[model samples]
Target: MAYDIKDVRTAMDPVDNQYHIVLIIILISLIIAAGISVLFTGGQGPGETLNLSGSLVEQDSTGQKEDPAETWIVRILWVDDQNRTYSFQDYPQDTKPDPKSYTFTGDPPPGAQAAMIRFLSWDGSTERTQGARYIMDPDSVTAVLNRYTLMARLSPLPTTTPVTTNTPAPSGTPIPGMLIPESGVVCRNADGSCTARFGYTSRHDHPVSLPVSDMNRFYPGEPDRGQPVVFMPGIHHDVFSVTYPGDATNLVWFLMDKQVSVGTVPRVNTSIMIEPISGYAPLEVRFSERSTGSVPNNPLAGTWNLGDGTITSITGPFYHRYEYPGRYTVSYTVSNACSQARDSGVVTVYQASYTWDTDPKNPATVRFSCTSTGDPSVWFWDFGDGYTSWEQNPVHTYQRAGTYQVGLTISGQHGKGSVVHTISVPS
Candidate 1:
């Protein structure tokens, strides 16, 4: 029977009191069991609670208040066997006028084999990692999460002290210290691109600001490539990166009188140059490999994907002919012990041909249609008479009717080709 809400309520109300109590008890038992399952299985899965406590002491205590605009970030990181990194970070604020210590908690991801802590300082635009420390293990997994303490002394923020001097400082008076440009690591990206990191070390007691000029610049390209103008006093790594397609090499950063080359690490750099990228069918295209790597005299094992169901392990400065007409993507890859690089280009093959349709009533007039491929930029049409036209598709009238040979010639960046057909014109 179909029961309404009132009917269902009445049916439920007829249950005995003891049965109602038993149902309530069963529901409570099920809820308690679920809670216990979650507490054991869900809560305890794949992570650990980390209690991080640290103290920061100023290198030069000036008895002055800390800059409100400045922020310090404490990061705890660990890597698993799969080379995946897990990080826990906290931003500590100054409670007092002069900040001293900080305390916070973090949850590190599972399989954390080794743990390290890094302290960073961020002042609006720039953020720099001051230093990093690896925690010594008492045991394997359990030692990473327990109560840990770190003590670090931070460098004083840059300040300008006024000096009373009546006479102007002599011209070319040497600056107090020097700024050395240093090249950091080269990182390979998943998209086959690479990045070279650059940084600087400031030996001065205070911060230095240099504009993008001859004193501070990058070589082989633009003078300014998003490098920092303001430098903090310390050895800061990876201040900026130069991202380019393929491997980076011979990139130099010029700071004052010092210069450093980036991407000094040994790796293969690949480039493909294809001449006459597009042409008529049975097109013979030239492919050249301009790849360079650190290993000199090392034979580069290269592979080419002709994109026409043809794959060859041929070292190029070679030729490949496309028998049919279509657009095909060509790729070349070169590899050695250091690393591998790959580049791709497109080759378009066009078939030179045309179709002509004559007017039914006016048999002397004809419309010539150019069906040639590859978007030919230049077209020449000869109507078998003395008249010629440059239009892709042209119409012509014959004064006298006879068998005539019409020709069409097309040309583009790919190359040039021509085709001719004999047609009978009626009188």
Candidate 2:
């Protein structure tokens, strides 16, 4: 043995030492066993067991391979039959599951109800599940409901790597839903599905047909005297006409929503009469409404002088007139102390008049002249000769004409008159 140190070292080689080989085989076996344990062991029944997860994930010093064990348990949400959900400690603790509830590991009691259960894991919302998705039977849900209990475990295990997700906001514009204050709403959704709507209307601060959220209220009866009136914000129509003594002042109009479409021409039926408008100011003319329950001040009522300065007395109730042609606009404004509304209509202006000015003997020339008075808005004249004019006075040469009873009319104003003139022409 004392011959050489080198010879002694060589004698200890693995080929000559059996214990080294044995130790190597044991190390290999231990490694294999650890691998098998990584697999989750399931329990009896259709239900499956899931590994515990952590709210946060730990990185391994060695970035080896994808390990099935990689995951974190953030929370446990268990839904029950009533669609209610319950969650216990994310990890097992001394505190017990509700005596009335069930545990994740145990079989549900008979007649128990439950919603979907989840063992969610995450590292700052980079999440994963403990097990594959599980859809319990409807009948089993009842069991979950009866037990209303869920369990979680806290423990760490060797894991592999995980992935990330895309985070974006929900789609579409979300309008705020709010409760209507005091009055609730003036008009709710035509069918009352959701909440009432609030908005602006060019025609009315509060439109009826368009529906509005009415927090406060006023007298609800037809706000505009039952005229199919709607308060919509935008250009719209609101018209009413009044006459003198005979013709009643009763015209009503409706405001509609066209959504920006070309609108139909609105026709108005108006009359004129000489009402002692300014009872005190005799010089100023006034047209009073003959409505049964007439209001003292109606913007639609007006009076005018029937042209030809000589006619002093406008002694009629009211005279009716058809649609006078022309391009004109009539404006009407309605007001209450609280709010105001206005509307207008287009009126086309038209004028025509026949003159019997020719002194029969003077064929080419006229001798007498005629004059008509009042605002086109005030009056119009119809020379019995099938001619009408909105002029104050007109002169003309009679080429050929016969007897004619001239007619005069006042438009929106309350006044109209007629006179006859005859002229003979040689044939």
Candidate 3:
């Protein structure tokens, strides 16, 4: 029998052919397995597992322990770089006379930057108290768990405290001392009005009830504008508020021998007022001297420390421009003869800018770079091609040659800002 050359070769190489076929089959199987794995895992691969453990104790300012029957609920919250929050909760065993210990095991989501641990104490079916929040970086989470462990001594809720009454002095020997008035805060309202809050410190051991009269009154308006008649012992903050027109001046409060003023002319007090305190850089801020209290022979003299390495002796309304993005503290101090007063304000400035370069060989492909200020932590890119990216600097390719609008937005600790640009791509 005569055999063809192909048949002769095939018969001699049957084992080799079989080996090649098996290898091809193995490669196909691996490809299919990889595809399935990606489909199930979303191509992100395995995540990092985190183990957290901590202890919590409930106590008040006086070091009084909480009830043994009370239980604490621990909440673990984490924020990713994109500002998304994820949470997990756990319960602590009510081991009285000792701090409650808790353990949490889970996978930390991708891009997690920070975490917070909050404790809520419960009594039966009702939550009794919410404790302090502990904040830490994600990188330090495991270290904190291993080294420090979660430990917090929280103050009990005010509502749960027992009320105690103080004994009054016998027959009232004039109550010993009087109340001191203080000007607290002057807040600007949105309707072009201003609200001035005032407080007082009572030196007496018992509550002093003083009717609204010339002894305790406000000037340049009604004597009694909801002023508190019954003064509680100890220091009280924002006890009463007086509203006035934005342009109103010389609002004063008198409590016996003590007096405080707001917007007084020939200003007896020192205060600084700033306009446009926060904005995008180059920010222009207006500074006005709200302190006009000058004596007959001693006039107020002051200097400004603008925080940006600049100091000036100019004593009138002035304007300063900040070229960089940052938080700047501006302070003014005035002193003459008897007293000195200082006032300070903070200015927050932010900036957002970017630059782009095109691929010389492929004009349709472009690379972007962010040159923003203020320490941006989050970035968003809009390519105007129906696709968006969260990357700080993203390279994109246009399908066809045309003009496209691109926008970049960034936000961080200081502030947020955005910019847009138009670009042309060549075919």
Candidate 4:
């Protein structure tokens, strides 16, 4: 057949070819199916699933008993790196159902960083309602899911497109002796459901109360002391339903996953007292503890630093003698786990004793001098007459004295000392 090339090409056109049309339709359908699959997978590449599990608790019994129809609406909230939020709602098993445990599985959307499970309970008959929120740790969720088989052929589905969340509440400031929970979690199913385990807080480290108290004590007491508890890192979760007054349902859930760290220990509390701190060379001083902490069997050690280049570890009362006359700074330090405490005082040793010399011309006129070896800041002298002098040396005239009592008192940084002597004047 001698046919025109234009006619032959037109005869083979796709619109005219049934097989070509069928193939084209199949290609278009495949593209649509792929796009649908991505949406259902929450845009995850593949094989990544988030597993979460917890229990549902009834915080309010009064309202549930009054209106059997009082139902709970549970939802999960997911936040992305951009702070975009999405929610997935979960329907109750039935109109009215008993509280029980639940598990959630899904693939998280790309750029998802944080997720929270919110429990909101309301009396369908009235306007009264209450809610509680638990923040989840993604690493914790993964660890828990690793223990179980992921849901077969299941992917995260977004219920709502990305939207701006409320101005996020400020994160709680970290406190001393307290651990701060992880932040920024993303979820797969918007508000449907999410699961997480507290991996960082697992039983390995020592755990303490959130707001520590002096009255709080370690668990498993007596036998447990010294023997550390073995905590396996995995999903640890618990749900609590606390009955709050009024229609409000207050619920708080937590997993004791972390060990408590030691924070500022109790400060060392005590004082030091020294008696006869200063005296002539060969001065002996008595040192003792004035007080210490009220805690029993305290872990504190006591030591003394004698200003004269001597340090000693002593228990109970301590006595030390200074061989040379000099001024020394004495300090005592009480060492304990919490802190080190110290107290300081000065000690002075005198060089010479009290002495007086009579004038060559007049014996009645006597020159009184403090030959004491130590250095005294202040000196006082009483000639036994009605006279007093604040001088290291003073000359006194005895009017008609057969015998007179002379007294000298010295005061220094270390302590105070006094001496008395009898003087005779020729009549």
Which parts of model 3 have CA positions greater than 4 angstroms off?
Answer: 1-279, 284-329, 336-341, 344-348, 359-361, 384-387, 402-405, 422-424
The C-alpha TM-scores of every prediction are 0.35, 0.20, 0.30, 0.27
Best by TM-score: 1
Q: Report the candidate with higher TM-score, 2 versus 4.
A: 4
Candidate 4 ranges beyond 4 A from true positions: 1-266, 294-298, 353-370, 373-427
On the 0 to 100 scale, the lDDT of residue 359 in model 2 is 50
Predicted structure 1: lDDT: 0.65
So what's the TM-score on candidate 3? Answer: 0.30
The weakest ten consecutive residues by lDDT in model 4 span: 239-248
lDDT of each: 0.65, 0.34, 0.66, 0.51
Q: List the residue pairs that clash in candidate 1.
A: 278-414
lDDT per residue for candidate 4 within 40-118, as digits (tens), equals 6676533334333332333353433234345554444444435333333333323322224433344455555325454
* Model 2 misplaced stretches (Cα beyond 4 Å): 10-19, 35-333, 336-422, 425-427
Q: Model 2, range 189-238, lDDT digits (tens) per residue?
A: 22322121122223111123423223212122233332222332122222
lDDT of 1 by residue, 161-227 (tens): 2222121111231243467777545655667666677766665323567777887777667777777
Q: Which residue window of length 10 is worst by lDDT in model 2? A: 179-188
Which parts of model 1 have CA positions greater than 4 angstroms off? 1-265, 294-298, 399-402, 412-415
Residue 159 accuracy (lDDT) in model 3: 25
